[model samples]
Target chain A: METKKIKLPLTKEDVLGLNVGDMVLITGQLVTGRDRVHKFLFNERPRKEEIPFNLDGAIIYHCGPIIRKSDEGWRLIASGPTTSMRVEMYEHWVIGEYGIRGIMGKGGMGKHTLGALKKNGCAYLHTISGAAVYLAERVRKVIDGWKIDDFGIAEAMWLFNVEDFPAIVTMDAHGKSLHDDIEKTSYRELLRLIGL
Target chain B: MLKLRDGIIELYRKVATSLPPDVEDALKSAYIIEENGSNAKQALSTVLENILLARETSRPICQDTGVPVFYVKVPIGLSQVELKDTIIESTRIATEKIPLRGNAVDIITDKNTGDNTGKGFPVIYFEETHDSTLTIDLMLKGSGCENTGQIYKLPVEELGAERNLEGVRRCVLDAIHKAQGRGCPPYTLGVGIGASKDQVTRLAKDQLIRKLTDTNGAPVLADLEKRLLNEINQLGIGPLGFGGKTTAIGVKVGVNHRHPASYFVDISVCCWANRRGRLIW
Candidate 1:
């Protein structure tokens, strides 16, 4: 697999060429969202003007980062992906509504997301799930955040400036998904071990 | 006498910032075994690098510092109530000093405590000891892996499992399979068997704290642990479920006698992080 370096505010053109198993070094601005974000967008259906961060040609990270405020600015202590599958039910709508081109997280999404990626020319990028401190080093600055008082730290939305952040593409725009394939293959092995 | 509050704070720092040597050793070996070009190998490499960086920086290994579960042992004539209060205060201090992510949430209000403590939060359990020494063991149980733990009521009709050791093996395998890669394997599993639900759940968590290199004291349980681990690795769920040769590093099991009417088994799965440590004074 080839390594691709991406500048953020990704366009459809940027994501269409990528395929599953390719490595990426993403640099630029991205927004962090998790269970609360997905639930709000899907259930509450906020209009474009009401939303705090831009989503057009943007990448949404499934993360709840550990951030601290200093006189200099904000510092991100630990930032890594939470499991993406938990928000599978709401991601397709979020992707289509916001013109999102990239979904970054760990433990890849499901059929709905795979379908949405194929439909919207998006891709799923899987990062090292528990490698929080190392991943935090990539965040040059914690740009801003919203809904901290309402959603709490672990479930709030935050924006960050990241450089050379690493991840692997596990789902691509062509309806290909690495997580799906592994689940099938492993299920067969499990049955065989049980003598089924 | 050692200051119990201060000692507990130190334990929090140790558990969050760095992994125990045995866990680090397992990850190092897992990295070597995974094929160089494969996703499994690459994931392990990042994890190993992260472990060192977390230690040097003294930051959390994972963003999810998780719910702190404390197992406290107090010597005879000591005040258990006072010890409980000390643990709570120490937790509040650690949350700010360690800068840990506040994880405790109010179920009714949907609000975070922001200090990692609340009504029945941090989940502390106390037991009286025989000796003069005081001991405290803490496990920072992350919800991702903790969510994957399964409890089985045996005589499983579908798996064709009976109430025997063979049946226990089947249940453990099923739990691992259901967990897949979501909990972040190469895992260390703790299995507990007993007459009731609560008994096995604690029994299993107790098994998780045992050293990976130590042999099981019971010959029969030891044999089962080895066999179950061998079978688990064969599942090919590898690091992060990306598929590789080493799916799990170790499996430990505990057994308890039960009434003839009931059989329950609990499986507690810890991810690659497996943050656990004990303090004795």
Candidate 2:
């Protein structure tokens, strides 16, 4: 019922109020995953206690980064966002199932996802597609990898502790969707401008 | 005559490593010039930065180092290379250096290999032309755009040329609408007319490598492209389908003469991040 605006470097007291199109800089822990990782979680059904990363109030990125073995550790060559729509079939279930508060990926969410976001107090964040290298810079650490060798880089489930991960709020919990609202208003404006 | 094996290998290497000039320029220009008030524009800016970072850091553009799609135009009289093997070997090398994600999965066996190189990894299409040099167009197609691809059949009896054209326009709009916030808008449309179901589908996929700025000289098709572009934009799908006037940067139609018994049309759409490249040898 009450909403608040938050700034970057979000602290415990600060709340993030993201509109659908607002560019945001996130600082904190974020997780990385893809279809394989999702299926693996669904099949394994890891206990809440046994889950590799904490899901509460954490942002999960639907991405598969190109990682190569290096002297320091695995090096991220490109880790861009994948289209989130394909994972939509599983996302709502995952958000409800895992208590995830935020999701980061390119492309907007569908109606079902919007509903899930509303019911679950979650938000859908979008980033630039094909901008892996630029995005990788925000990542400060690779915390731990669950089944790293099994799924490989693109398909692997790797947890990342990141800082200032840039994103836009595309869907919100209050049924306020920046994408839907923008499309509606913009179309009306275009129609008026063109006398259509 | 360039040695067949060597030439093909070289061509494959070039195609795999570098992005096509037109495609690269268009993407860069889109980021700079195209402005829709959505994450799409910001994302485009980030994508440009990412591209630069990827090149500078020697990383694959994206982690899902996509399945390779090759379109080769060979000269009939050019005595140069083993085209097929060239594709295989070049793909193999590119998979190693380009470090592409191993996407080929054995459908029946259900096996997973991490490297993006395997049997039928670089899907190659070859055409023999009356010329000297060979032109190889390669596209690193990720699964996101690939999955959004669709094929709709319109029977000739029910939908004649007028209707089929209308049908094509409808299909494009439907795809954009249904794919809202998916397929990453400010995208490109590939339309295939004529040919069998598989043929039409393949034709549309091949056009993914054609740059948005390039236009074939058929007046009818060009007009179709223009009309489809306008209609789809009117849907206000915008960039990334976030709602804007620029849903598609361009629409490309690849037409083939089909049999009279029945006619078919298919449409394939690619996101703004069209990851394709070109090479000649």
Candidate 3:
């Protein structure tokens, strides 16, 4: 699809214009959240008023990390991306409520997230999971996070400002998704390969 | 057996509550090595670097810490002081000290541990294998990989070994296809072949602990792992399914003596992070 690579610290305009085939390296604040945090946002009252972080032009990463203790405090040990589909249930609600501009995670989103992306000028990006140790290094700073202690490393919503965060466009505002294209191509190829 | 308050406890607190040594090394590597211009590569580098920074600065890496899945093999006749209690107590200590996010949910009563520890905390699996030393492999198995697990029951009369083999091929392909950029590709593929549903699932999960470069004992299975690895990569599911040839770095199949009645096969896909640590005492 004649892919183009864009370096990040991307603004809302940059993310909004991206298509499904485009690749981006985001360097900025990416607040990390997963099932519990997403659920918490959706379940909390005043859905519009009391959001956790500044949502304008921000990127949300779907991840749960493996954290280790250090003398300074808790350090992010491994935080590879998690499945993005689980957040599909809350993606639309989250984008609308938080004004989220881009979502970075593994896996593609559902119809709700797609619709929200189209309507909200947002995009979905995929990060390499299982590369937590690798990915965690790009984190420049931990801005803030919910102190929901006792929530395991995988479920906590820790926020961090990052640089050159890797991701690929999976879903764009216009309803284009690399995941869909890959699925279709793979299925077609499987049919031909298997002689179905 | 290591005392819950001492040996095993201390180890679990150390391993379960912290990130492995290699994880930090891997993160640093991704941060320094940069040649590919793809955003996907940069994304991986960023994530890995983030892990390093988190470690250096003392912060939780990416939020979802995950449920602690402890695979403990206590040797037969090896009696340690309160092994189960030790494991649980260590989990509590780690949860509090390591400050793991409480993830265990009481099936009937839903609540947060606020300390990442609670009822049925750290799903522990016990196996009495023959040995004097206990082996504890703790995996902060994320839901991303857990979500990729699948089971298929092929009709013995219809599929047979050829189709059984085909079934494995198809299942593995389907997993990669369906996963696309999901399950965080360039993942470790786990295949379980056995008689029942549970056995196959266990086999698949255990396969995650196998070395990334090693294959199963059986020649056929080894060939299958190679074939599947090649085939899945050809799908262009690359690093994060960004259309590359390295979607999966390794594939391992674990088989059990199935009851002659059926061939139940399952596949578990673990993302490249493959967060698992091994401790022996």
- Output the number of the TM-score-best candidate: 1
Question: Tens-digit lDDT track for model 2 on B59-100?
Answer: 666666677777888888643356676567655555666566
Native-vs-model 1 lDDT? Answer: 0.89
Top-lDDT structure, candidate number: 1
Residue pairs of candidate 2 with colliding backbone atoms: A20-A169, A20-A178, B4-B80, B4-B81, B101-B116, B102-B115, B102-B116, B238-B244
Name the regions of candidate 1 deviating beyond 4 angstroms: none
lDDT of each: 0.89, 0.67, 0.68
CAPRI quality level assigned to candidate 3 from its DockQ score: acceptable
Give the least accurate 10-residue stretch of model 3 chain B, judged by summed lDDT. B155-164
Q: Estimate each model's TM-score.
A: 0.98, 0.85, 0.78
Interface RMSD of each: 1.0, 5.1, 4.6
Give the total clashing residue pairs for model 1.
Answer: 0
lDDT of 1 by residue, A1-196 (tens): 6899998899888999899989999999988999988998899998987878888988899998887778887777898788788999999999999899999987788999999999999999998989999999998888788888899878888888889999999999999988888878878877887777
**Tens-place lDDT digits, model 3, residues B1-281:** 34535654455444433455544454344334433775556655655555555556544443445667778888887654466666777767666664555566755554555554576666778888888778888777666667767777765332232436777777677666766766666677788988889889888888877776565789998998988877876776666666655677778888887787777888888765556777787
Q: TM-score of model 2, chain A?
A: 0.81
Assign candidate 1 its CAPRI class: medium
Supply candidate 2's per-residue lDDT for A55: 75
Q: Candidate 3, residues A149-191: lDDT per residue as tens digits?
A: 6344556677777777666678998888877777777777655
